[model samples]
Target: MKKVSKVFYITVVLVILAVAFGAAFPDQFEEITGNIKTFVATNFGWYYMLLMSAMVIFSIIIALSPYGKIRLGKDHERPDFSTATWIAMLFSAGMGIGLVFYGAAEPLFHYAVDAPTSEEGTGAAFKEGLSYAYFHWGLHVWAMYAITALALAFFQFRKEEPGLISATLKPLFGNKMNGPLGVLIDVLAVFATVFGVATSLGFGAVQINGGLNHLFGIEIGFTAQFMIILVVTILFLASAWSGLSKGIKYLSNTNMVLAVILLIVVLIVGPTLLILNMFTETFGLYLQHILEMSFRTAPLEGDNRSWLDGWTIFYWAWWISWAPFVGMFIARVSRGRTIREFITGVLIIPTLFVSVWFAAFGTTAGDVQNSGIDLTQYKTELVLFNMFDNLPLSLILSIIAILLIASFFITSADSATFVLGMQSTNGSLTPPNNVKVAWGVAQSAVALILLYVGGLTAIQNTIIIAALPFSFVMILMVIALFKALSKEVKSGK
Candidate 1:
């Protein structure tokens, strides 16, 4: 077997000890992490909002600047994947299961259950619900991702640096990044990736369990979700075993097809006109109030402040936690493209796709609730299935939804295993399978531990805690990348 770096052994041991602690003292683990998570959210909610907003602005300026012409690779190089395939791969790896997991649930939550500012189940809430959904899942999420990916791709491909997050900062830190500081940076990234992907894995298990319960009367509980995670862990591990290009590529393209089918079916079978109407109106409102929402701390209103802490703040942390994994995976596949094209495509394509996705599923959900279906009666994980219950071909739609979630579940874990393996192995493009297996198991174990501790809330808590330190690393990465880009322009290389 190949010699794995010290980083691999260190991260594996850390993940194991953390898992053991969570397993041995689940309540204590949950309470401690939960308290820390709340403290971070309360004290640093403004920081989350401001940092995310700044990243979005940074993404736009770089795409429009003269540096936009700089290719990710050598100037003569071209993109590795076709445009459509590239988009599918990035979108699938970026936000696949999230769209299914929250498509109907998030907007509907804001609309009927606990709206941001408006009275629940009112016209005002309806608009605000979808608008907030767009706000959360749209431009900023991708911008956070785009900035991280841009830094990695620029440093790794253009400058011929190692494909590590630490390597991206070498412009500012120089060879010091190759010392203890670099190892610490990579470890934090792995820590964030492990907990972050584990959090998504928890959601996937819950939603899959929710779908099974909704479809076949299976009980929705930790046992069932545990089983769901167990089965998925085996499957995605197999996908990881199959290596990256063949199975993962096929899966990514298939995800897009299935997602498109689901979206069109829902729009056509459900309230098509209403879906279009909400999409147009809410999209406008999302753009109109984006600045307000971007910096909104809601210091005055207790109810809205609580809502910000719960949703907006949580999402910012979630994206930051996800940045390392998603950013690395994206940079891996985004070679040979110009910075402008990369940022614009990574930014716009998914933004438009998810905006329409929310419109179709969320508007239909709101319509269902308006028709007196009481979607609020269902759990968040089960809301989508129940919402489909009031629509045409509900059974088939639910089936497709489950399959999509499972596919995304496998693809996400598969990609994370690859990313973890690379990060731990000094940025090996094809890391040893043994290292991948270690990461794959560790990820699943962490997911199971989180579910055992407190289910979705626990998952949220872990990611929030993991994202904070990495957020600081990302701040430095932006500075390093800017320094490198300026040097590039000056050298005329």
Candidate 2:
């Protein structure tokens, strides 16, 4: 006989209802979500900042502590994948699409439009912009992910618990996590995963459309973007049908190769000297200002505070929302490693790669913008393509970028389906194909509605709102992890 978890039914209903409402009354839905999103950012901004800071501190302390030697799985069990493959998988599943989408646009925004703390269009703004971009995508983001993955992997692999977020908290809640409360916790993780991945999918779709517009003369609008999502949805669904190891492993490695190739070409043709200079200087600036930027609130100035809400606060919420999916996916692939190795690899490797990545793409965009040509005239998605126009082999670069985005879109969405299926099916590693397919459709549908109703702003609004409840859940998980780790360390396990 077959059994099903209630989480699958409940979340499907909730997502369907929300999608239907948004589809029926998009303007009203958009307005309501926007209001709620604003409310969370304005009221809870300080809480987010404090929590994120704590996450970073905790990750570092754990990696360097005696508990660092604890294996995620049994002491004798070896890693399921090699270090390179493991990194490629985690990095691809972590920030594959985002790095491409924002690599060029974000620093340019801070430099040309409104700088975070400095005046726009100055050398000061240039440094400030890139440094902040590094801060957003660097340690804090990875710390949140590292903690979540460590906790889940520790409990699931070491303690022989089910591979679910709720299971990680049993040290505190005991068997209370086995009842309705546990179901509630799992449901929150599932919803956050659904919305977070959908938001990234929306970004990927828009950027793919933007690339097409630049290369071939296709118009960039809702219709084209929706079709783009539809096509990619079908593609990723097919990948999901193929199951986890074969589909995700191949796609993730492919994503890394294409990404490295694109990165190299951008550096070669676009201001190599300046890119290296910015990489060296801004990496220092990022470290020097880490504490200041991490806890900054801009309480006095209205404009700076608005920028905080838009960028920093929003990113805290974004990474937290994304933590469940990325964290769980990371845990699944990170079996048999010591806690210290896992955290160190997760934190330092991707952070350094992303820093230099921004150096290449972002410094190039800033260089082009400084030449008295405005790159901001294009939409956010189109900014990368427009910047490429100024470099040699512009057409070749655009083609490679489009290919890379599509590949990332498939990998991210495909990895997400497996994670969502596991969450819904009581943490089954091999969740049924039917369940994964259903989740694939659900995520794509949510993305479509978000794009249809309010475009990019809607994606941001929904993610901010989705992340707030999950933030509480994540804090509790951190406490539970500490409690369990302490008991184990005392017992000399």
Residue-pair clashes per candidate: 0, 0
Off by over 4 Å in 2: none
Candidate 1 on 1-493: residue-level lDDT in tens?
1457777878888999999999999999999999999899989999999999999999999999998999999999999999998998889888978899999999999998899999988998999999999999999999999999999999889888878999999988889989999999999999999999998999999999999998899998889988998899899888899988876788899899999999999999999988998899999999999999999998884657888988999999999999999999999999999999999999999999999999999999999989978888888899999998888899999999999999999999999999988888888888898889889999999999999988898898999999999999999999998889999999998
Query: What value does the lDDT take at residue 129 in candidate 1?
Result: 94
Candidate 1 wrong stretches, greater than 4 Å: none
**lDDT (C-alpha, whole model) for all candidates:** 0.92, 0.93
Q: Look at candidate 1 and give me any clashing residue pairs.
A: none
- lDDT (tens digit, per residue) of candidate 2 on 77-171: 98998999999999999998899999999999999998998999999899888999999999999999999999989999999998889999999
TM per candidate comes to 0.99, 0.99
Model 2 clash number: 0
